[model samples]
Target: MALWKHLVQAASAITLAAAFTSVASAQETVNIGYTGPLSGGAALYGKNTLVGLEMAAKEINEAGGFEVGGKKYKFNIVALDDKYSPSEAAVNAKRLKSQNNTPMVFTPHSGGAFAIQAFNEQDNFILGAYTSVPNMTERGNKLTLRIPPSFAGYVQPFINVEMKAFGKKLAMAGGDHDYAKAWAQLFGPAWKQAGGEIVAENPMSYNKDTDFYSGVSRVLAANPDVLFVGGASEPTALVAKQARELGFKGGFVVMDQAKLDEMAAVVGGMDMLEGSVGVLPLIYDKRPGTEAFIAKFKKLYDRNPGTEASYHYSTLNAVSEAMKLAGTVSDPKAIHAKLSEAYGKLPPERNPARITSVDDRGGTNANIVVGMVKNGKVETIEAASLGQ
Candidate 1:
């Protein structure tokens, strides 16, 4: 009787162990790849993007993961640093696709996006491009998703605001990166079209050069009323600071890549950023979605979130929702097709930028808010008012 009782207990224990194993195996992991400048001058920018992606992934997993085709799956971000190099981005994409079978890859900078775009459709992975450059989505890569609305709309408004405040003699002093080059090219002609004159153009390496005295001096020598400057936020701030030190008392046309608030942090205060125009600082946005996102992000990161964090965070959440709507986690094409529906499902609290929909070519659409520093405060310049 004692032997029979012991055998019954052992069988019950074995059954329980098998049940635990089955439960563990039920939820699978889906790898999502990210390749950006995680270890270079733009490390902060890259880290912000990664933080947003990871934060959203953690939230999804904590809520029991998303389900598709009657199976549950959680996201696992497979992040690799490309040091802001386009060639390295391409290599990372190949590795992510071959090894992890990631259905999507996110790249923050336009250079990396363009490089990956060259082969992303071929690799069957969606490109979560975080660039504002209009051409990124215009190329028509079927699997690409432009996270931020195009900077194209900003050109007219930017020229209008800066030209109104400062004289029309524009001097180019932005970074030499692909993104900045594109912005300069776009702005130069537009500045001319808007009845502005191009006085001087000087492109310097924002990442490599520390003392921009020579470059800024050259641009300042042109006696232009407005300086076109941008790169990553920190370096851009340094350039602006150096220009101020050189006695440049003109307005600035800042590119959308560098956040004005972040630059203010580096340059002491908004006093230094006075007369500068760029993308509106996220903190200034009074939308309920923006406020909720900032609160949640601050709780997690212990600091204010910028456009980099907000945009990437919303993009990741939207992508996850797309997977659920498409009812497949592995098919990039299907997922891309469902993005519009996915964005619609995002609640107000989840969609910080309040992106309503994506265009047919893949770019996300929303009102572009332009901010200008006046009296040491960021004042909103509605895109509608600017005729964007």
Candidate 2:
């Protein structure tokens, strides 16, 4: 009888331990990964994106976190610095998937975003981003979602205005970066489609070299009526300054990467930006919903929100809403499906005017606004113009 009692006690202890372990495992926290350039030329972009994500996480946690299948799971962010390198992004993606068990990743830059997109496909992880690459969502990659308007969508309005103002004879001067190259590839076809002629195309390497006199001279020799300056703030500004200095009085169409302040500062104030058109929607414009976001972002960061920051914030909101709607964080596939549905079903108060719907491939049907630099700031020249 003593031996039987001892055996029963051991079995009871094992059962209790197993039950406790199961409960603990079921209450695991939900982890979300954010990958971007935190220590390179694009560090500002990554930093701003992180701020947005942090804000979203704080808001969600304040609301008692996300409820999933009758259980409450707190949202946690695991940020990995890829330094804007494709290889590093790939490695970071794998780590987030395997070790962190992250079902979704938010990427900011184009190269890193595309790298993660490729990895997500192979690993069956859901990848979302504010990066504006149309091809990222073109093929119906169910696991991929884009938060911002694609480069193609954004560029169309600028192209339309430029073609109408300056008769064809286009010259492309864009950075050699992935995003810029992608823009260049689309520019030729897009310009041709608008009945414009491409006189010459020149790609310049930026971030390392600042002297764009040579590149500007080359584009000048083409004698095009207008030049397309594609790349981030610094390079675009340098190109514009150098082109103007070289006595090229032609019109300039800056890409989305060229922020108004940076362009004006680089090219000797708003005079250079005057009459120049760009693709990025102006953030500080007097839009109905944007004012609240701008005010809140300024209060938190103590600075005006740029395109990178605003887009990142919007992406985070989209993700959080999807999680809430799905009511579970276990299956990434289900979460992705929920995201698509939530994106469309979001109430007007939760939805931004820029974004309308998500297609089957997770491409956002957002309308891109056209703006021109006037008086040292970006002015919305076209309202609700879907350049398509």
Candidate 3:
């Protein structure tokens, strides 16, 4: 009897240990990757995006992470600084895919996003973020997910509104970056479509360019009724300031990169940004859902968020929603399908005013809001009426 009792106790202990091990093994973690220029001229852009991403992740985790297959797993973020280099972005993307096995990556800029998209197309993972270039999604890459309205979609309204107000002749200036080139190419065709003419188009190299005298001189000589500055904060601001100094007193159309605060800082104040038009909506206007996000962002970072930052934040939320819908994050195919479904099912409160649904190619049908920089802030000039 003593021996039998000892054997029974041993069996009980073994069964309990096995059950505990199974439970622990069932708990998994979902890792997400973020790649961008954490250090460089675009560092601020990357930093703001990171802040929003982190905020979203924290909130999700605090809410008991995410549920999948009746099991709960915490979400983790693995961020790498690509320093705004395409080659570095490719390398980081490969690492995330092979080494870390990350399910999705959030890229804020065009160059980095493009590089990752190239690899993700083959790997069957998800690449989500805001990139204005339509080609990023137009090529039918099954993995690429864009958050913003394409430059082609957003620029038309801008042209109609500005051309009617300022005249037909237009001058275009942009950073010599890949994204700016893409924007320039798109704008040229779109401007012509809208009964406008591009009198001159010039490209300026970024980082190595601090002086816009030569480019501004050429633009001023063209004497366009309106000027379009395409690039990130600093370069666009420099071009705008120099154009004004050179006595080209005309309305300006800033591109997606020129956020309200950065433009104001570059032009010395809100007065300089006054009358400048851009593609993003006024996010700080204390709208119902937006006010909470803006308030949280400011409370955490003590600064207003930009388009890039907001897009990144939304991407995080969308990812969480996708995971919940799919009930698993390990399978990229399942997650991708779930993302499409979740986007359609998203409540009005969770959806952005622009994007209605995620298309088959993972592209969101997001509309654009045309706004003017006034009093050092972006104010909505017109809500984009799609197909107009």
List, residue by residue over 1-388, the lDDT tens digit for candidate 1.
9999999999999999999878766447889999999997779889988998998889888999888888888999999999989999999999999998999999987888899998899889999999888988889799899998988888999999999998999999999987899899899999999899999999999978888999999999999999999987888999999989999898999998888998998989988788999999999987788899999999998998888788878888888899889889889999999998888889978789878788899999976789999999999888889776
User: Local distance difference test, per candidate?
Assistant: 0.89, 0.74, 0.74
TM-score-better candidate, 2 vs 3: 3
Every model: Cα RMSD to truth: 2.8, 4.7, 3.5
TM-scores for every candidate against the unseen true structure: 0.89, 0.86, 0.87
State the TM-score for model 2.
0.86
lDDT of 3 by residue, 1-388 (tens): 9999999999999999999988675456677888888997778778877876787788778888777788777778888999978789878877887866788877877777877777786876788756767777877777778776566666777777678667888888878877777778877788888788889988887547989899889977988988888676777888888888888767787777666566777667867656677765446444555566776777887877666666666667777788888777777777877766666665533443335567776677654567766556677654445334
User: For model 2, how does the per-residue alpha-carbon lDDT over 1-388 read when each residue is reduced to its tens digit?
Assistant: 9999999999999999999988766565778888888887778878978877777677677778766666676678899998988778878889988988888887876677777766586787788766777787876567988877676766677777777676788899888887778788887788888888888888898756788888889988989988988677877888888887888766778777777666776667877766688754446466666677777777877887766665655666666667778766767787788765666665433444456667778877765667776655677765346445
Q: Which wins on TM-score, candidate 1 or candidate 2?
A: 1
Give the least accurate 10-residue stretch of model 2, judged by summed lDDT. Answer: 345-354
> Among all windows of ten consecutive residues in candidate 1, which has the lowest summed lDDT?
21-30
lDDT ranking, high to low: 1, 2, 3
Greater TM-score among 1 and 3 belongs to: 1
List clashing residue pairs in candidate 2.
68-327
In candidate 3, list every pair of residues with a backbone clash: none
lDDT of 2 at 177: 82
- Candidate 1 regions exceeding 4 Å error are 1-27
